[model samples]
Target chain A: MDSVFVHKMWNDHELSKMINQDIPFLMLSDQDGSIGKMYGIYDEDSGVETRGRFIIDPDGNIQGFEVLTPPVGRNVSETIRQIKAFQLVRESQGTEATPSGWQPGKQTLKPGPDLVGNVWKVWKVSEAFND
Target chain B: MPEEFKPGCQRPPVKKIDPETAAGISNESVLKEAKPSMVKVGKPAPDFTAAAYGQGKFVNTSLSEYKGKWVLLCFYPGDFTFV
Candidate 1:
C-alpha cells in the first residue's frame, strides 16, 4: 500500500510503462492528509507528508516502520531485509531474534533469559553475518 | 486522455475564496482540530478507506481489506516530487 499526501491519482499504466514495475501494489491518495496525520508524518505548515514506510504483518500490527524527512529516500533493500527478519521471528514464535545485519540463510539467536547478559559470549561478533 | 495530459494536470483547480473569509479561517486551528493520535509499533494500524487509482479506474480501498496479507504502507510527500 502506497499513500501520497496529494490527492491526484497516479496514471498507473503510464508509470508502469515507464518504470517497468511488474509487482502489483495498491497506491492510495490521502487527499486530505488524514492518513499522514494518523501516521504522524503530516506537516501542517507545508501541507505535505514526510516520507514514511510501515511494515504491517498479516494481523494488522505494525511490525516495523521508518519515518524520514522529505529530502531522504528510503532504502528498499533494507525494508526487504526487515520484512524477512520480522517474518522469521514471527514464524519462530518469538524464540528467535535476528542479530544485526542478519539476512536470509544467516544464523539467528535463540533469545532466552540466560542469554540476556551473555549475548557476546554466546554469539561471536566475528561470526555474525555482514554485508 | 489527450496526448498533452500530464500526471499532475488531473488535480482539481483550487477554489478562490474571499480575502476576508479566508482570513477568518485559521489553518492552525484546523490543523489542531484534525491532528490524529500518533501510531506506535506493536499496535493495530489505524484503519482508513481511500480512493486509489489503479487498473485505469478509481477504487475505494481500506486497510482492513488487506488484513490477511502483509502490507507495506509507503507514504510520500506528493506526486512528481524528487526525493
Candidate 2:
C-alpha cells in the first residue's frame, strides 16, 4: 500500500514516462492495506498488495477480476476488451455472448439450443481476424 | 491455586449474553475479521473511500461514487517497481 504522495510521485516520475502523459484516472492509496485486505490482495509480509485488478459493474457487483504475482505484467487492453464484452452481454440482457477474443463490431453468439453444437459452423476462426 | 482470589467465596455474579443473538459474527467488523480473504464474483465489490492522486491533484474518492459506470481497480505491488 502506498501513500497518496507516493502515488503522486510515481505518476509524475515513472508512469508519465511510460505512458507519455499523466494517468488520467485515480491512483488510489490503500494505506494500511484496508482496501487490499478487503480485496484479498494484501501481502502482509511485504506490507504491499499483490498485483490484481477488479472490474466492478455499475451495480457494484464484481463482474471480473485478475490476481497475479509480480513476475507477469497484466494487460490493460485485455481487461478493456473483457469490459466491453461484459457490457455487451449485459446490454443484451444475457442473450448475446462474446466468444473468446471477441472484439467490438464482431459476431456475438446468441446463446440458445440452436447454437449449442452449431457454433463451430457459425463462428469461424477466420472471422476473429477478418474484421 | 491462589487462595485469596478463588477461595469459592464472595465472587461477583456472572453476566451473560444470549448466545443466539450475540454470536459475535453478527456485526460487520466481526464478519470482516472472520473472512479476510478473496473477493467473489457476483458479490458486491467492497466499498472504499480513500485519498487518490489523479489528474494533477489530490482528491478523495470512493467506490460508491462511480456506481453508475464500470470501474477498474488496479493494484500493483509497489510505487516504483517495473513489471
Best by TM-score: 2
Q: Model 1: per-residue lDDT, tens digit, B2-79? A: 344344412333345646556797554553444466789999998999987655455799999999888999888776
CA RMSD per model (angstroms):
6.5, 12.7
Candidate 1, residue A58: the lDDT equals: 95
**Residue B64 alpha-carbon offset, candidate 1, angstroms:** 0.4
For candidate 2, the docking band is acceptable
Which digits, one per residue and each the tens of the lDDT, describe model 2 over residues B5-69?
A: 53321232334564645775555344333658798998999998999998899999989999989
Q: Candidate 2, fnat value?
A: 0.80
Q: What does DockQ come to for candidate 1?
A: 0.36
State the lDDT of candidate 1 residue by residue for A1-131, as single tens digits: 23432222344434565567522665688878888888888776657778889999999999888988776788898899899999999999999999987888888899878888988886677655564
Every model's DockQ, to 2 decimals?
A: 0.36, 0.30
Kindly list the per-residue Cα lDDT of model 2 for residues A20-41, writing each as its tens digit.
Answer: 9998788888888889998998
Name the regions of candidate 2 deviating beyond 4 angstroms: A125-131, B1-35
